[model samples]
Target chain A: MKKLINGVDQIVSEMVEGLVAAHPDKLRAIENTNVIVRADAPVQGKVALISGGGSGHEPAHAGYVGEGLLDAAVSGEVFTSPTPDQVLEAIKAVDSGAGVLLIVKNYSGDVMNFDMAADLAEAEDITVKQVVIRDDVAISNPDDRRGVAGTTLVHMIAGAAAAEGKSLDEVEAIAQGVADNVRSMGVSLAPCTVPASGKPGFTLEENEMEIGTGIHGEQGVERRELMQADAVTEELVQHVLDDMHLNDGSEVALMINGQGATPLMELYIVARKAIQLLKDRGIHVKKTFVGEYMTSLEMTGCSVTILNLDEERKRLLLSGRE
Target chain B: MKKLINGVDQIVSEMVEGLVAAHPDKLRAIENTNVIVRADAPVQGKVALISGGGSGHEPAHAGYVGEGLLDAAVSGEVFTSPTPDQVLEAIKAVDSGAGVLLIVKNYSGDVMNFDMAADLAEAEDITVKQVVIRDDVAISNPDDRRGVAGTTLVHMIAGAAAAEGKSLDEVEAIAQGVADNVRSMGVSLAPCTVPASGKPGFTLEENEMEIGTGIHGEQGVERRELMQADAVTEELVQHVLDDMHLNDGSEVALMINGQGATPLMELYIVARKAIQLLKDRGIHVKKTFVGEYMTSLEMTGCSVTILNLDEERKRLLLSGRE
Candidate 1:
């Protein structure tokens, strides 16, 4: 109902300005653009990492830009892809002689823009590589598997490798490795995101929820009844565990992220059961991370992601490079 | 409303267990106790740091337990204080011969339980000092000020010093300086938290917001009419700036934190205008952080906090030790 914004339209631009004002030491905002870059760019020898997507997934495409993550991130309006020109400018800003790697989520618009940018940049004599993360197991391909929440792993693995001066070939390889291993699934009981319009995005009836939801406030596969955390987790994790194809005695890394409205306490409760669910199957979970890594604008629910780790993923998980 | 919880009473305990399971390398849950400790606490002769309040602020007491902040944290049930015994156990679990420093938010229940633990720990010859953060500028009476979002700064600044191996007294001095300089104020358009019974904690009709809200879903100072983000930030920042007694040309670290339900884009938009408002008044903002640091469960709104900064405070902030 009530909001603290100047214009419904200027929300993203305004936020970018404030972030630059706050972290000049770590970042800089391009004039009149949705791109934020590290103060140090075109390092002459290292591959640059570029990422961007909708604006609502804060700290995701941008907050993660620092020493170990993205070199530049172009932000679109809430839940929308940055235009091709915006992505093109970002590529121009961060591209070094070493080439640029575009970390893309498997969204149609995102794929189109980044792919176009890659073609443009390559035409300009700058080499570019792109990786599309389709790690969300929530969507079954019986209809069509869609991308959801596991993109964080791809970012970390690729960003870490890029920051370490790894070759584009090596970085893309590691990103592919991580992407192949991670899977995410989400469900929401209520819809609560404040769009740039200064209005809450969607409203769920008092007794309704959109289950198997996506981060953009998109309706899920079904609006199943919202149940207890344990029961919800049981259904969610079963989907993830089965999707990951982890059998008894498998080892993994789990992330239980809030879609905004879920509190810290309940996230932990859900994650606690998720661990037991895995343990009961003799699946050895080596690591776990729980928090709002990537979120839908103030939506209240939690998603569980399991990264079935192998020797390579385990090494990259601990590797603090990017 | 849909929820993912068993009996409401078991929410906090169950969540704590999940956090423990999530980050065994980074955190360890106290056996049969509602406390969490950094896996590598009590390094040789470093002062241990512990902070906790209610259960809703995650990655807070628990989320912050890794490398940069907090050696240990004790969580109370949702909106409740941890028992004194739990505090004592957390203190003992992390206390080295170098002693421990307790950082307590100035909530009445929090103060009493932490102080009770201090007295209990003192009886056992453990040297302990306390820094009570009462920085919410929204509340009147400095002594009666309610600690809000700025309390996180206390934990971080003190946690940095402690990790850098500052003596207990030195850490206390730095934490006190942060506690003295920081101020926070919160607003909410709704009140919906999970009670152990898995029901909404408080209800706010659409278009109604509780101004000057509290962390545990406390009734706000005024059920005033809600407005745009620009107006919201003006009211909240003005409250903080005035109550903190900051004048023109003051440099502060600004934060526009969501109370769960508000989106980051909207929060950033608000921060944009708030920054403009301050600049117009001749104040220089040295830093800005916009996200959901402390949240009211599923409430759709944002809060603003400012921490006055000097060279020393800035140094302490920039110097984040392992």
Candidate 2:
């Protein structure tokens, strides 16, 4: 695999160093740990928000750490959950008198590790709450669903609520509300190589694709000949709509998230079709985001996320720093 | 080559539609044209800024077309320059009595077309000025150096200057200063396919890379074995530093631009090395931007841009809408 990296073992640490170096005004790395926090963290009385998982999804948990988003993000090795110790460091570094909330994706590894971190933090007399996001609608069993790009929406709304000095319970409730209402589905045209493995997680023929692929290159629901962009986008959006049970006059926030290798040009193409499909169903798109918010390392594909927005959610979603 | 797109013929139009649709609050498309303008265009006393070129460089021109950025951007087909007529439409659509400034990359096609558009606008009594950016230090012959990712910095600075109610001449001077001081170099591990051609622009073995590759997939200065991220980043930054003649106490802004397919993790790795190299030479990086600012479809590599800065330029660069 032709990847731009040094030793595989140093990927996460080096990346965190580079990230903090590039944005010293906004982000800082905790010494000797894979934890990144807002440069001006631990506001004395504001609710602190923490979210993180694996390393490959750059700009996800860490990139979202700032004034109106996450307060701290603890990164693990690629496609692996962070140790509870790292998460606890993030919790301790960012938690002020107002308490801390953990916004986690629905992967079992992430859920377990973050919960352990929360338990550890509570033992130190810090109030902590947790919200698990299961926004991916691909799995037939809701409990088996994996959070994907829709977790970005949760980050924005909950972070905004927390930045507004909401109580820990209020922030947790807002985050959980987002997790309950958002849906996402993804397709992959190519697989990504883990730096350490030096092999693609999966493979597809030149003209084939995987529908409903998970972010970590998990087996998708189906393998089929690649279809046109509009057709692929239609399938993804239709699944989200069906699961959301939205009728006419519903308003929602739309996100067309690119896997690492997809070009922004193509993401916008997918966005066009997604907006058209949603409009045809008489659903009003309140806000739309089109870019790589969550990504698999070097994977070529896109995911469509629909967040059912209420008046309060819409207000908070639009209130963040650009 | 797999891509998320509909018919090749519809790629630019659909992408533009999606872009404008996704950002209705900030952008609008001129009716029946591939021209995107600020939603509140023709801001009558503020000098207008216009920039455009081939469409594959997503977010370069259009994504920068909001407040404190470009007043308008014209998009042509993939790897092809926008026609003078389309550029004229953009010029006419956004020009106010204060006049308009054209920011053109140093490519022959883009330079010729934007110049022609400026003439067309002048004929209509709308004052117009132009700045040609030739920031790529890859070509030994400075006259042949191609503009690359540094164009984004030009957009940010000149656009901010224009947004501050500067006259056309004043904005032109600032843009020209930026173009004159910036230097960039890139390396590509693989080539990207133009959608219309449906073939890779160039080929490379798994272990090879093209050093100093242009944004349009042009042949590079050298082909060599792929190297470690730090080594590759060092080579890129060294060339830029040599060409810029920066001193130990100098200050500048650094940009590590992803070509397309490179993950953000890898980009930050490159950024880490680039920043360290600059520091070792006692140069301070006043600002740093790391992401896919300028891209060449899905090419797997990155470019480094260094812009020598002064107090005025730094203020303008930091004064834009984020």
Candidate 3:
């Protein structure tokens, strides 16, 4: 495990400190907690948004904590869900008179903890709403799917709505709509190690890959011989397209997300194939994002996210924030 | 080597195609050339900026090609400089009546080819100016140091000047100033494989690292047992500090650039230590950037860049663009 961290126990705290230190004007950390909030959080009369998960996925929960995005982001241990207390702190730190919305990914631990945090918050007279994002289509059973990179779209669109001073209900509706309309699937060329474990969650032979892998290295649906970039992209995009069930003229936003270690060059190559695939099916890609929006430590792979877009969703997606 | 690429021959072109596809609103490729120009290039009365080098270092020249950045970015084969003719095409495509400026790295091939292209453009009556960025402080002999991640700062600061309607001379001078004031050093834990070669650029033992490695896996000044992130960061930052001779209370911008394969988590860990080291020296870090700006495929490492800042440079760095 040749990772560049000081120690296993300190990775999360140090990372939070480092992030706030780097962007002090934009973000700050809640005392004694792994909760990061916008520097000027708790804007009076504005719905506040919060999301987070394990610490390894950089720029996901915390990176999105700023104007036009998340109001607060809680951090757990790597690949571990945050405690309800941590999530509760995030809720308190960002909730203004308007209320708080928790955008949580659909991992069992995450769902339970965020829900518990919302309950805890509501008990204290804080209006808290929660939306579970289950956008990953890796499993045939949609109910069993894990949320993945499509959650980023939810943050962007819903965050914009909240920033525009939407009521808590309106923001929740926008978030749930995005969660319902988005789908994502990923392939991992390699696995990532949790800092405490110092060993990869899984392993593969030199010439093999795991398709439809979860961000936390959950067992993938299939392990196959390595294929060309186009073939792999085809498999992932086909799964997403089939699940979305869009007609020829369906318009959508596309995101090609790198799984930690993949190069931007390869992500672009993947994006090119994905766009071409969508065009062939008569799907219009209105907005395209290519980068590591969410990641699984230093795993080498990528995910494709497609969000069915309407006028409001498109407008909010493209809207700017301070 | 395990990589998500179509093939060695098509890697550069495909990557370029993919990049432009993902950002059509902001970038376009010159017909039949590997040059990517701002979608609305040749902005009359605004100095056009051009930068390029080997292809492996992505987002270096290309990703920076949007509003407030380079007017055009020329792509070369992986780790190989683009030919003078290719650069000449870039010069031709983005040169409005306001003239053009070429930002070339310190590599011999890049410097030679960009200079040749400038000469060719001058012959065609296009006012062409060039700035050769040599910001790496790894080698004690500054004249022989290779340019590293600091080139990205040159692009950001100088590119903004060009976008603000600065003349070729003004942009060239600002670029030259940035080039002179910036310094960088890097450490690599693992080497990346070139697509054509299908072999790691260099190798490291299971618990070893190379301090002061160049972007292309050039031999580092020191190779030793792997140390904690803080220790490694101290070595790199100390070298940069000593080279820059920044006084206590000096204001500057700092960047922690990932070398493709390092996780963002690790980069922030490194950033925390770097920031503390600078603060302890009374150096005031006005702005900090953390991510992969210029990458070497999938190398597992990072580089630290510090740019001495003045009022003009700080304002430009913070300025906005469409």
The candidate scoring highest on lDDT is 2
Q: Against the hidden reference, what TM-scores do the models get?
A: 0.93, 0.99, 0.99
RMSD of each: 2.6, 0.9, 1.1
Q: What lDDT tens digits, residue by residue, belong to model 3 across residues A1-322?
A: 9989889999999999999889999999999999999999888889999999988888788999998999999999998999999999999999887899999998899999999999999999999999888988888898888989999999999999998989999999999999999999999999998878888999999999999999999888899999999999999999898888699898899999999999899999999999999999999999999999999999999999999998899899877441
User: Candidate 1: fnat, from 0 to 1?
Assistant: 0.79
lDDT of 2 by residue, A40-145 (tens): 9987889999999998987787999999899999999999999999999999999887999898998889999999989999999989999888888889799989
TM-score (chain A only) of candidate 3: 0.98
DockQ of candidate 3 (2 decimals): 0.83
Q: Residue by residue across B120-143, what tens digits does model 1's lDDT show?
A: 999999998999988776668899
lDDT, ranked from best to worst: 2, 3, 1
iRMS values in order, in angstroms? 2.1, 0.7, 0.8
Q: Give the C-alpha miss distance for residue A90 in model 3, angstroms.
A: 0.8
Ranking by TM-score: 2, 3, 1
lDDT of 3 by residue, B178-243 (tens): 988999999999999998999998999989999999999999899999999999999999999888
In model 2, pairs of residues that clash are: none
List where candidate 1 sits over 4 angstroms from the true fold. A142-144, A193-207, A247-249, B197-203, B245-251, B280-284
Best by DockQ: 2
Compared with the true structure, model 1 gives a TM-score of 0.93
